[model samples]
Target: MEPLRTVTVRALSGRVGTVGSGDGGVRMTQLNGKPVQLKEEADEPGWEVDPDDDWGIAVVETVGRQLKLRREAVGMRAADFGLAVGYGEDLVYKIESGKRIPRPEYLDKADKVLDAGGLLSAMKEDVKKVRYPKNVREIAKLEAQAVELGVYVGLSLHGLLQTPEHARALFEARQPPYSEEEVERLVAARMARKAVFDKSPVPALSFVQEEAALRRRIGGTMVRRRQLEHLLGVARLRNVTFQVMPTESGAHPGVDGKIELLKFADGTAVGRSDGAFNGRPTTEPKELRILELRYSTIRAEALTPGESLAFIEQLLGET
Candidate 1:
């Protein structure tokens, strides 16, 4: 049995390949037990893909490269690494090839197994930085990557479900005007994040909304109606759960702020405390725990899924 190592090799056998491990885009190889160092090879495969300019592709490829490098450094083949990480070899290949984003558990195992010095975890933050709207970048990135999302929206609609008309109205209300082009770019990016809804093994989504959010006419009657309809459609998704916190229910923990909790396949969790207009704020362990407790408390106080939908329908009928 060859000492299994996970590395992105250059094939060295024709068709030059790019080297990398996970999100870092840095590659490593070994020659005679000595770690072979690789640079940011502009000549590596997919150099033409332009990681810097294309936020999503660049971040995805970077993570894949990092995973490949660290795996090889440990002298493990993709199958061996996947087995250790409790994933199928095919899944490992998908992650390394940038065809799939890794589940949180796989990344954690890789972190310890590869002795990656927290590089894998750091890539989560790096991807957030790549998305526009610097403030909600983390939320956008995480929402796009999460396998399950537990979210509370106290203000307006969540970004993913907001129609272009609603999004534009909200953005235009900003103190500083966003140029038409900037608005379009942001909207395009937001819509792209919704791809998660279509991801295979679609993530379980639970959205708890405040009654006020339902009443706030973001883009006027027509826009609000469309937004409500959209929510109705999404709530009906097989993997989605929708709840509403009634105004009559009285003061709850979320009264202070909006929050979103992302639970990855590995059981590790991260959270955000800001809305789309405000940049997404990362939650540390202590903070994440606090939010979790608050979320549990609030969910307990909110309406049931059946009641919530009826409530929304009642509101829609009124308007």
Candidate 2:
């Protein structure tokens, strides 16, 4: 009888391919004989293309065509090309058929294999933006320049403040369902938005989270614990002012839905709320004031910054 020992390997997943246990990249561990193969949660296979993105679609198709042409010109079949590039033939086909987005690494590999002379690699800039959802890219663009951001979310934590595990779970729980690829793409995009917190001067960020959003128990016990811990960390940031809106606080303007306000360094601002003005984004000063007033009220009703951090710490302790 063989006494089993666990071994771990770091690789990408979410795309089934030829790898450990024949499922692309598996983080195999914890077994008696053969290792228990587990999916690696970290890694974005570029991103699934948005159906509504005409420009993105065109770019993908053009690059894919170039890849197929280059491979053919080099006298390599899809399988041969896939082997040369270290990806599954099926994945290679998906990329060439424009059914899947080609990752940066894939482009680099393809460029080398097909001898495209850095032509394929240069497409990464366009491909990178195409990978994320259109709305996510737009929101990220707005966040990049905003000097102040005030956000209120009643049902869940804001994307910018979510941990990868927490964000992945949230996306996985969506209804009507997203494909495995879609989920990873979304999670990647959401996490990418967190880059706003890393800007040079850092933005003045404020978040008012409903008490229930904190207690919702997303992604199970460990996930909840980690989320609470992460939330506490973000809430403690010097530039961030976080508040917890207790259910006991009674009715408030934010009870209608989520609200987001971003004020730019140039004195321009954009505001949006699910409950107000049909949920369309607005730049008008009068409309912005209404949202501002509502947000102020919500912040007032929420637990103070110090109190919120303490309350979350208490929750984390229980978890």
Candidate 3:
């Protein structure tokens, strides 16, 4: 296999700022302070919608154009402007060219630097609406359109079914960790996906969770207790079903890990697995069929929805 390529951002005076993977070979550029590394193959089909679809590109373009105009009006060169914003000249150029999305902080600093009277800062909200990383937005969109959804979770509560506190705790526990702003953005996006539960025509939702997941104290005693109580409440939903796969049900299909299958009204479907198919979500019928079979088997091995509620209650009482 070929070695991964890297890009090293450096200052004209010979100081490295940041290093990130590049498409095919090592490349060097000048930039200010360190910024997060950019992925080589940024867009993954089916995982994320095209940036052009959600006014993402247009918003970036507008913001970039405004920044450039303001900088030119102030007679500031890219390097000087970048220093004012605590970023690199290359990054400033990237943002101005609409090739990069400026972080909220970057815009705030730029606004102050250019003395734009809050104009740049005002773009933060618009940028945020279209700037989710990875496949989060796409997954949320699929969940929204799903007429019937089946889930098998081995380690944690599904995002849609989580309460705010539970979801916050989960995001906070991620490795490398997310910034406060990032955590808030993620939590808000996750919560927004729950709107499907209240749709005019309710969707059919089913979940099979490993027993261990229910017992795990993710966010301390009180948080765990509240989560259990919340689960019980959601279990009462008329259009939802919940089951607990006992630990004793060893050697189950779900041992491979989490699985999600969503069926839509138009006869199209999508499925995702943590263990198979390269872990990428797929819309292929054959892949969907396999995931459905595994999910069905996991559900079969789990306690009935009624029993699952009782199981949760038992755990709650123990807590």
- Report the number of the highest-lDDT candidate: 2
Worst 10 residues of 2 by lDDT: 1-10
User: Candidate 1 — which residues are off by over 4 angstroms?
Assistant: 1-131, 274-286
* lDDT digits (tens) for residues 1-319 of candidate 1: 2243454433221112336577555334443445444333221222222233566566767788888977777667775565455454555776788755454556677787676767787676554344345555656767767888888888887777678788888877877886655565566556656768888889998889888888888878998888888888887889998899988988888887788889887777887665332534554678778778888888899999888888889888987
Clashes of 3: 2
Error of 3 at 316 (Å): 1.1
Segments of candidate 3 deviating more than 4 angstroms: 1-134
Candidate 1 displacement at residue 156 in angstroms:
1.1
Alpha-carbon TM-score of each model against the true structure:
0.57, 0.70, 0.61
lDDT of 3: 0.76
Tens digits of per-residue lDDT for model 2, 116-174: 66888999877777756876777787887899999999998888888888988887888
TM-score order, best first, reads 2, 3, 1
> Residue pairs in steric clash, candidate 3?
31-88, 32-88
